[model samples]
Target: MAAPFLYSAWVAASMVLVPFAALTETRKLRRAGVSVARAHEKLGHATEPRPSAGPLVWFHAASVGESLSVLALIGRMGQALPQAHFLITSGTATSARLVASRLPPRTVHQFAPFDAPGPLNRFLNHWRPDAAIFVESEIWPQMLRRTHARGAKMALLNARLSARSIAGWQKRPKLARYLFEVFDLILTQNDQMAEAMVAMHAPPDRVARGINLKSMSDPLPVDEDALFEARAALSHRPVWIASSTHEGEEQTVLAAHHRLLKTHPDLHLILAPRHPERGDAVMRLIDTAGLSATRRTRGEHPGAQVYLADTMGELGTWYALGDIVFLGGSLRPIGGHNPFEVAQSGAIALSGPHVTNFDETYDAMVEAGAARIVKDSQDLAATVDSLLNDTDARDTARAAARSFTESQTDQLDTIAERLIKALELAP
Candidate 1:
């Protein structure tokens, strides 16, 4: 009964939202630098024909991080179910590029359609996926309902429900229950999130505590030639990296670097902005600080005190050049970026207190002594100084991080088997 009302309400809301969403997409395409010509893909228009053979499993992620988190699982599942072909969809242009560059064989990438009746139906008709899997907190009512109507087995993987969102949903319990009930299974990131799912009326049996999948993801890919050049140019300088930094955080990072420079004059800082499109703005910021900086986009070596690695898809290369890494996005209330990538790069991870976005993973890593937290520039500089000065502590943290990462491997196997079994049982 609630399902009918919820569906009707969603239909009405989507009808009203379609035009606004289209305008928003145009703005995002402009800012994010995706092609305007390919913008039709977001309206449920297919750029490539659906594969003619094999059962298709559709995975939808909202952006780069979510897409990367599930990538290994998809590969493992594809290997186990060789007859299955994977269709991965994301809404962001950046994510689409990463998917195209790194996607495995028997898999394809597409931009997801907007959540309106026309677009959702067109996407469903063309792809006809046997199973639909959505990552994290992306809940689209039209997409969920339309996919369910088409008889696709739906699963929510590595799901997270923030406290604020939970509070909002509690006020609309029937609507929440109706929407969550659409998922055949709900694999949550932690016990807190699992409890939230049950509280919101997702069947307790259907919802299970799952490990954070980012801990098991492969390291971001690197370009070998660039890596070699960067390493050779450094010539064993005392180095640290501030990776995936947002707007306000870079100022703090520069201040921290300035302090560190007073003691070690040749200390090199690799500053990687979260969005490479902010490269020009970052250059101006460095100039304002009177720091000598070189942009990686220009294919320059690190001859200055600071290296502005403002390029895409080369985090692995930068990670290899430094041992002390400050994971960004945490310092500026942007939640936090993943730290496991730094761990995989064999660096000691340092982060700020605002890691609620990756709460479970960060907490586990901290408890295991694999990561350290910083409150401000002074704290960050001190932590980096301590780690770089003590080889034993640094190596121990590095080893603990890799061990923590290794301990989570079996969870993916369990998850893959369960998903494959569920897909097999689906009509």
Candidate 2:
């Protein structure tokens, strides 16, 4: 019912790219994982498959945030189904690296097959998963249809549908109807998203939206020795961190840093880009801002300048190093990255006003006064400087951050239970 309409709108929904195969294939080959570029790469070569006939659960997380949101469930699933093989797929290169960084034992990571029919069919033929789970709002017409046809129990966990996305889905209602019908259970991020999915043709009675996974603590792992070394070198310098920044937002951090240094002479700032490939460009932007900063890829200390926390999977260390933190992509129009990650690490969380991507989480944080909102660059600098100088204020912010993040971290658990029932598995 929902298949062909979605299949046709793959283009209209801006879902499929006509030139992606040609553009991405060569880039995937040319780029190396350790390099500054290729940060968005999600999967590796699916050229060969090792056959497995056991009960295999397939978890699909669209990118870095969506991918991380499923971690708790993945860990719990492993405990519940220790005998079952687990296969997880994330859609971006950075996500692949992050998943590879800390996935629990027994889980294997793969790049999601492109939405094209041929690759998806090939993947289905080989993996033969017993269950398929979607972390968020990833709808592939062919993938859903064929996976159901393969006798796999399909569920959407921690799903969300915003007003903006709803409008677009309505534009292609025929396609959306097909996509919506394919799921046996749709576990949403919030009540609003669940209501929206209902309007979009998801099974109303089966729809459950309650747990918000982004509010979970950051699984950012830090090396104790490395932490000691960085801290020893940093030495009482008031610190702040900017994690997962987008374009045009770098200058804001730099501008804030310049103002912050005036009052707190030893104020140190760290920049962790959303894309690792853009490390050099961010370094250049920092340099152009007339601030002396060192790239972490080099062994240089922050030293009265900024430190580019340009390395991947090291947000744990950076978050630990900073007292005040800003989760970027919010200050600009880019749907802000996860604020929950920093909050769990005990950093004071702040953002710019444009956090439409995680509005519910952001609003909750604001209502709790766990996060500070900076509407523009000037407010950004002022807010950061104030947080840095005032210990009580910083502590208040970090407390708010932890409270909001801790409160919303259990969606994965709820989804896990529903998934078991949907699969008709024994309790």
User: Highest lDDT: which candidate?
Assistant: 1
Pick by TM-score: which candidate is best? Answer: 1
Writing each residue's lDDT as its tens digit, candidate 2 over 139-232 gives: 7666787788899888887787667888888777667767777788887877778888888777787788656666653467887877887788
Query: What stretches of model 1 exceed 4 Å from their correct place?
Result: 2-6, 23-27, 30-37, 425-427
Candidate 2 pairs with clashing backbones = 2-178, 5-175, 6-175, 36-277, 40-93, 41-92, 41-93, 42-92, 42-93, 43-111
Model 2, CA-based lDDT: 0.74
